[model samples]
Target: MQDTASQATRKVRAAGLRPTRQRVALAGLLFAKGDRHLSAEELHEEAVDAGVPVSLATVYNTLHQFTEAGMLRILAVEGSKTYFDTNTSDHHHYFIEGENTVVDIPSGPVTVHNLPEPPEGMEIANVDIVVRLRPKRR
Candidate 1:
């Protein structure tokens, strides 16, 4: 328990973010489970259930702060629904449509080709490929 808190504090500080009570608590919940994807609302619910008094807005704010600090990546898999991925490495995902779940695709297996050149004065930052999936119908 104490180790998790300390680890979270160190992580936050390393990202150049202040390790506030809420930030540390949230970070603990986030990274403790290893690499995973979750939405702000889902995290907020976890916080509440864990007895952490926090608002949904704060969760969003902290998540954005982490994203800006490069600790997380924003994943938009579904319409109007955004997920934060703890694994910030370059990789792809498989989004299960009905289950609303995101699963990581192993690196190096998926290849992308034939990307058009960007407009003048603009370079591509990163490419995100989300392959939507559904159960085969009979």
Candidate 2:
């Protein structure tokens, strides 16, 4: 079986990003755990816990780079909190309001209709839907 480091290297390179040591390490952390969402602070804490020796600033830069390279999707929640989603496919999400958790909505369940037309000479990009969830009050 391929190790995590080499796999991260390949993944990063495949996404048109140069696999530096720190990038490879961060990529391993981001992709090794399967698809999930995390903020830069969370990832920085994980790096510290894993002894990766990376700064939060570097983590932010790396995540933005990865996002630009289409390796990740960015989700904005709670007005100021941003989470990076590892899954890049076309899908919606469920954001748990108080818990700060993000859950993937199955691909076929949610359907959107009646989108407004874009301005002249502009094309519509993919649509993103974030369904907020909270505990039902009894």
Candidate 3:
């Protein structure tokens, strides 16, 4: 691992993650873009293109573990496969329908005006607000 990513791995290990080679490589790929969203397939393809020496299965497992560890947010796009978001802060996303791309929307002072309350026993784990949008036709 490089010096910069060694520090990153240390931080992730501090958060109770093992920081395995696969996990560290995946983390580096995710953080390399400086805040972006990518699907598992997309990431796997990128890794292969860059010759990162990781398998697709490892990508999926690392994604799941990283998500469970709160390192990334899982974006469940209705009627589509899930996307992994690099931004960890409280925010929403915009799904471009035909593009199959997700974009983060600023959640500043955004409050849910009308929403049903959660069930008595189950607590709110996440609030996924996705805006499916279409490009303006000429």
Candidate 4:
């Protein structure tokens, strides 16, 4: 069986990324826990906890690079908050309001209907639906 680092290295290479030490370390943390959402700050903390010795800027850069390379997907839930999703498949998400977290809503559960045509010379490139959820008040 391939180790996590090996798999990550292979994945990065396959995605046309350099697979540097920092990228590999971050990839391990991102992919090891399976499909989930994470932010650069959260991932930087994890890297520190794992003793990866990476800077926060490096984490942010690596994440953007990974997303561009099709290794991950970016979820912009709010103007100030952004998340990195390991699951790149066509699916929606549920944003927990107070908790500031996101969870998958499963692809088939939500269906978009009657999307308006894109402006002239432009095209619609997929839609991202974020269903906001919060605790019910009594």
Candidate 5:
């Protein structure tokens, strides 16, 4: 069986990113558990728990790098919360208001209708749909 470090190294290289020590360590943490969403601060905590010895700034930078390399997706919720998603396929999400968490909404159920064309020289990259959920009234 391939070691986690080696797998992370290959994944980093395949994404056109050098598998630096920090990047590899972070990647292992992010990918070890399979697809899920996480925030920079949350990942930083996990790194510390795993004894990775990385700063929060480094965590944020690595997450952005991975996102830019198409290895992750950034889901911006509300004005201040941001979540990194490992599943990059086309899909929507449900945001739990009180819990501050995101859950994937299967793509088959949501259908996007007409959207206004982008201005000249621009193109539509993708549309993000986030359905907010709150606790039911008593």
Candidate 6:
């Protein structure tokens, strides 16, 4: 199996990202944590701690670029923060409400389909589904 660092580089390159030092480094940090959903601020801090020379803005930009290129999935878990996902497969998410965190929910054989067809002209590019859940009130 390929190492996480190598896999991150591969993923960015495969998504048409140049895989520059910054991009690779950022990807490495994100992918190193298995199945993580992190905020830009959190990632920026991690990257900073990892000695990566990327500014918070650059981190945000790279994250947006990765999401746009389908290398990552971005989720809005309320407030003004965005969460980035290393897993870009067709899957759903369960947002841990009060904790303000997200987790991938495997659909098994079932997939999200059967949405009404797109309007005449615009193409159907992608579908993002977020399921929010909070701790049960005792």
The alpha-carbon RMSD values of the candidates against the true structure, listed in the order shown, are 0.6, 1.4, 1.8, 1.5, 1.3, 3.1
Give lDDT tens digits, candidate 6, residues 47-76: 899788899999999999999898788887
Instruction: Output the lDDT of residue 91, model 2.
Output: 92
Instruction: Tell me the TM-score of model 6.
Output: 0.80
lDDT by residue (tens digit), candidate 1, 21-56: 999999999999999999999999999999999999
Q: Estimate, for each residue in 1-138, the C-alpha lDDT of model 3 and write its tens digit.
A: 497478669757965899887777778778866889999999999888877899889899989988888888898895669899888888988899889989888768556766678889977776788888998989
- Clashing residue pairs for model 6: none
Best by lDDT: 1
- What are the runs in model 1 whose C-alpha is more than 4 Å off? none
Model 1 TM-score relative to the real fold: 0.98
Q: Which ten residues in a row have the lowest lDDT in candidate 4?
A: 1-10
lDDT of 4 by residue, 10-108 (tens): 889999998898888889899999999999999999999988999999999999999999989999997889999999998899999989999999668
The residue pairs in collision within model 4 are: none
- Candidate 3 lDDT for residue 111: 67
Better of 1 and 4 by TM-score: 1
CA deviation > 4 Å runs, candidate 2: none
lDDT of each: 0.97, 0.94, 0.84, 0.92, 0.94, 0.84
How well does candidate 5 score on lDDT at residue 90? 85
Report the error of model 1 at residue 112, Å.
Answer: 1.1
Q: What is the lDDT of residue 125 in candidate 4?
A: 78
Q: Give the number of the best model, judged by TM-score.
A: 1
